[model samples]
Structure formats: C-alpha cells, structure tokens
Target: MPKVTCHNICDAIAAAPLPDGMHTKLIGIDGCGGSGKSTLARQLAQDIGARVIPTDDFAAWDCPLEWHDRFMAQVIGPFQANQPARYQRYDWHSRTLANWITVPAGGTVIIEGVSAIRQLFRPALAYKIYVETPRAIRLARGLARDGADAWPMWQGWMAEEDAYVAAELPAKQADLVIDGTQPLAAR
Candidate 1:
C-alpha cells in the first residue's frame, strides 16, 4: 500500500471518545515489517496512557508464527481475565527465549507487529489500526534495519506477510488505517 500523508489520522483518534477506565481495551497495531507500526503504537500508547505489548518480543527470528500459542496463553488470556500477565520475550539475536515481561492492568494495551491483528485475535481487540506504507519503502526499511545478512530472510518475511494479510483481510477489518510514514503531530 502507498503511504498517505493525511494528518487526520491522529486527529480522528483524538476525536473518539475515550473508553472508560473500568475495562481493558486492546489496540492491535498491524503493518508490514519496519513500516513504523511499532513506533506509531508506542506513541499512541504514550499519548493515551496505554501500555504496549510488542509482538516482536514473541516472534522468533526464524519462525515468527510459532509464538501464537504463547501470545494467547500469556497476554490475551490474562488481559481477557482482567489480571496481570507475564510473557517470555524472544531473544532475536540468540534465537532463543529471553526474559519475561509483565502486562499490567487499568489501561489500554497496544499490541504492535505484523500479525498482531490476525483473525484469531481480532475478537479480543477493542480497536484495530493498520499502518499503510509502500511496499518498496517498507522493504528498504526492513533491509536497513535487519542488515544485508538478513535480506533474503526479510524478503521471505515480506512475502509471508503479504499472503497472511490477503487471507486474513486485516486491513478491511481495521477500525482505522494510518499512513505510518508521516510524522505524528506534536501534543
């Protein structure tokens, strides 16, 4: 998808009525790899006093989809139960499990990553945001971030993401679509 320079994205978010503090709300931030989905999710969480749970922490370097069960068990289940939940973080460099992180209560949680808004988790999300960026730009960003050593892997990941999104229809299901290449307005 081509990146749109619409400043209205955050404006729309701001205009929406804030959810009551009584319930936990999950915000799924979905996009192609290195498309600024994480950045936007973090900023939005900070702006709205929400906590961010990055899906990158769950995905393995070689097998990103393998952590779905862990994600559901640790994060989603606890949040749905209205309790604090802890999840083991993936060590991307070591390609192993790392430290465990806890998800706290009382605020919206931003789940940010490529498959963060997958069909299995859609019902659990209070709102979904799709970050639309150009494929060329996304590929450039991914390669730059991951380095030349992982270029082929990155390409494969991109193809996998394309196939997943096509089958899942996350963009069509999204409550909001943001052009992540644009700068967010200063609060």
Candidate 2:
C-alpha cells in the first residue's frame, strides 16, 4: 500500500524469493504515460543485468490495453517453458510490425508500459511494480519527450489509464508502488 522509498528496486527484486513456474521471472513495470515506467525498467534491467520487453513492442494502434492475451501467448508462454520468448516488434514510425525479437531464457525479464501488469500476466510475474507520478509532472514529461503535438495522445492515454485503473486497482495489487519522481537509481 505504501510507496517504495529511496531504495534500489532491482536489489529488492533480485533478493526476493521467486516461485517456480517460469524459468525466467517476469517483472511488470506499469503506469500512466510519462510516469517513468521505461526509466525504471531500464535502470532495473541494468542493475540486475536483466532484459526488458516493452508492451510498446506489441502496440498496433488498437487499444494499447488490449495486449494481455497476445502478449501472454507469444511471450509468457515460451518463457514459462524455459524457452526463448519471441514477439513481433511494432514500428511507430512505419505503423507496422518490423521484426521479431527473441528473448532468451534468463534470470529476470521486465515488462514495461501503461498496461504491462495486466491480470493475465500476474501468475508468471515474480513481482509487479507500478510507477505513480502526478499528472502535472507526467504531462510535463510527455510534452518534453514527445513535443507539444503529443498532448492529444497523452490526454487520451491518461483517460484510458484512468478507466483501466478504475476497473482494475493495479496499484493496490502491486508488489511495489514507486514514486516516479524518484528515479530507480542503480547502485
């Protein structure tokens, strides 16, 4: 229920006892747009020498939240079997699927994005992390990163995130709720 203080998330995860099911432990990093999920994922990946697969890789212009089934089948399925997980990466520039990515069996695999911690993927996750940042800060981060033209998209995403969160209390279910303003600094 409380937020993660000044601590290395990767350290916490690496030390936590993991349950057996998947050869690779999954960690979901989820939050609203510009809430620092990607930053946390990158830092955690580097900290524990793990790999990350963003839901953006599966984005197809349809509701981004609608990725649980496909992601579970394509990625989680293989990982659970101790085999490499494969996914077709979506290209935002071209608006098409560009290439297939192979994620080998490993210690930890991070899933990062708005709806990364969908209910379907929970059974395979070692832990779930939800980044919480204020709307003002998130909006500022979005404008700075995606430029002024992205406000419309960000607004729509925020609304979607709100509805999703309302329907599913992800934060309450999270193993660790992080303050996005605080970076997941590597030690």
Candidate 3:
C-alpha cells in the first residue's frame, strides 16, 4: 500500500471523477474502533468543505452493523436524489435516537466508522479510506476513552469489528490506506 499524507488524500478526492448520474461525491473512511477514523474524516472535511457524518451517530453498543437500512433511507437516498439528508443521530449516552442532523445536497460528504465502507455503501462512494492501526494501540485508545469498566463491552465490540474486517476486507477495497497511529496534519 502507498503511504499518503492527508493532503494527498484530499487532492485525490477532489480530482476523482464522479460516477454517471451522481450529483454528490461520497467518501467512506473505515477502520476499527479507536483507529483514528474520526480524526482523518474531520481533517479531510475541513480541507475539502465536506460534511462529516459518522456511523457512530447511528451505531450503538448492541447494533453494530444493522443500521444500514436507516442510513440508506435517511442519508444515501436523499443525496442520491439531490436532496438534503436529515437523519436522527443515535446518542450513545442515552442509547437512543436524538436530534436530527441535516447534510445538504451536492459536493462531498464523508461517512466514517467501522462499517462506513461496507458493501452497501460501496457503489455510491467516490473514494474509500481505511485506517490501519495495531490492535494493542486501538484497545488502549478505547480503554482510555471508554474507561476500564467498559472492558467487556470493548472486547465484544472488537470481536464484532474483527469479524467485519475479515468478511469485508475493507483495507483491501480501500483506494487509500492510512496510518492511524500518526497524526494527519492538514496542508
């Protein structure tokens, strides 16, 4: 895999040709939990004026990858029709659907999370990114953010993520694979 700076990734996105009959460019940033997918997504969004919609907003501790139908109906469907995407964010704190977030039509939009680049979203994506980080580092990050009490939950989640990775092979499907351990500085 070729190592690329965030700037290079942004440039590639900007230059990438959109598929026929598509109005908006969708980018998927996929990685395991605590793999710095959010960091990279934010940086790319800031650099390129793209909207960032994290899959975390939809996924909960129990439902890891089952929110695809809702995602397709709320976000992808609207964007595909050149309309704004309005979807409820699943607040992890309350473990329920929360406030509505709107993503305007056209231009670039990023969906970042564990299954952000799943088979369901592949056809609409103009660019795909997978963040590669060590399992030890990822677990450490998770423990730091979620606390030691959440260890069992984290373990289960990690298992689910591993199964997803094995089944999907997102890194192999990615147009660009990035180092999650390094900070992605914007140009």
lDDT of 3 by residue, 29-60 (tens): 99999999988888889889999999999899
Scored by Cα lDDT, where does model 2 land? 0.81
C-alpha TM-scores of all predictions: 0.86, 0.90, 0.95
Structure candidate 3, residue pairs in collision: none
Q: State the local distance difference test value for candidate 3.
A: 0.90
The predicted structure with the larger TM-score, 1 or 3, is: 3
How many pairs collide in each candidate, listed in order? 0, 0, 0
Ranking by TM-score: 3, 2, 1
lDDT, candidate 2, 1-187, per-residue tens: 4345335575578776565856688888888888999988887787677899999888644465776777888898888888899888889778888899999986898989887777777778888998999999999998998889877777777788899888778898798888888764444
Consecutive 10-residue window with the lowest summed lDDT within model 3: 1-10
Our model 3 lands, by Cα RMSD against the true structure, at 1.4
- Predicted model with the maximum TM-score: 3
**Residue-wise lDDT of candidate 1 within 1-187, one digit each (tens)?**
4333333444554454434432567788999898899788877776777788888998866776667888999988787777787998888888888998987864678899988989888777877889889998898888888888988788778878888888988888898877767876654
In candidate 1, how many Å is residue 65 off?
A: 2.3
lDDT of 2 at 51: 93
